[model samples]
Target: MRSILIALPLLIAAPAWAQGDDSELWLTATGEVAVADKTSIELESINRFSDDSGGLYEIELAAGVKRSLGDGWYIGGGYVRVVNYSRGTVTRTEDRLRVQGGFSTDAGPFKLSGRLRLERRAASTGDEIGYRLRPNIKAALPLGKSDFRLFAAHESFLPLDDTDWGENAGHDRMRNSIGVSWKASKAISVEGGYLHQYRLPRNGRTSATDHALTFTLGVSL
Candidate 1:
């Protein structure tokens, strides 16, 4: 586990070592309130920055409920509101509905988890609807008897249905990240690390690569 944790950063950064890409930042804050031993209500907000990393160009607000189905399986459903700012103007707003299920297991000293999510997206301007699927996997290793954990994840977005105003059917985006999580207390934890995102072109546009710093704060109650 220790050796794997030490190698994760190098593995995550190797792909973009020679390529110059846009630098961005993302911060997400989340709070969870327990409804039962296996259920919780989740709330989160994500702020995204652009190349110069000056101000937020996008924001995502999300709320959801999740339940453990016994063993290492779980299910969840959620809603999201996305706001985008660009070119000195408010560009777009999106409403999203999502459903997800996943499973996790302990593998030696590491915990491995995988999830599949389906999303329906509606835009305010065009009103066109789009569907997408996101699949991701993560591995976590706890530093012995400590409050620190090392984790790495890779997530991919695949369009399911085409819409005039949204992503077309194909690969949409890929995000890979490696991070460390610190438990500040029983109810709070903080995570921050490097994330690499690759976006496929839409229509005739060029592909984009984003090298970003990802930060998150999680609170449990």
Candidate 2:
């Protein structure tokens, strides 16, 4: 039998953009408890910047809208905030704003969706960055009593640490993951998988890498 363990992240990832006008409002509250092998990525000099970089626990609350256009394409925008209380001493608060465009359709028992994210972020260190997250494609399959899905995603993070000067930090990150989804019921779904993420090096340094086991829960409004 196929594993039902990998099911949450991909299911909720793009349903918000499956089609145009499918749902005007979307809401979901997911409480996930996981052990992060690494706390944070190492930037450059440690004395200049201090972060725990240890095991971590995270909780995320997300709510947004999925608007579909008359054509097969759709566009969506929303804000999600995450509060991280690390095992290490540092407490981090992250806020993200994204606008996404996608195309969706169904093939027999499965549905396919794709999206791109344009974003800006302000880090706790008071660094603001502009970047793009994309190639986030998902496919949902119906398997008799339950459902399944697959996701492929790549996210890039840019550094705007120096708005004061034209000199840029020139840093970006990329993440690649693959997982499966199980529709436990209308109200919830469970998913977990392996995520390979690497923080691109900047200013003559090596890259930081992480291979993490990710679990996500999906709920409906």
Candidate that scores best on TM-score: 1
Candidate 1's C-alpha runs over 4 A off are: 1-18, 52-54
Per-model C-alpha lDDT, please? 0.86, 0.52
Which regions of candidate 2 fall more than 4 Å away from where they truly are? 2-52, 57-60, 70-72, 84-88, 107-110, 127-135, 140-146, 150-153, 156-171
lDDT of 1 by residue, 41-93 (tens): 99999999876444678999999999999989999999999998874467889
Q: Cα lDDT of model 2 overall? A: 0.52
Q: TM-score each candidate.
A: 0.88, 0.60
Candidate with best lDDT: 1
Give the TM-score comparing model 2 with the true structure, all chains together: 0.60
Local lDDT at 201 for model 1: 82
**Candidate 2 per-residue lDDT over residues 1-221, each given as its tens digit:** 56433445435434433432221111223532222321111111001111233344344444445555745676666666655554555576666676777788887766777777665554464555544444466666665664665555555555544542122445466766666666777767766655556777676656765555455565542
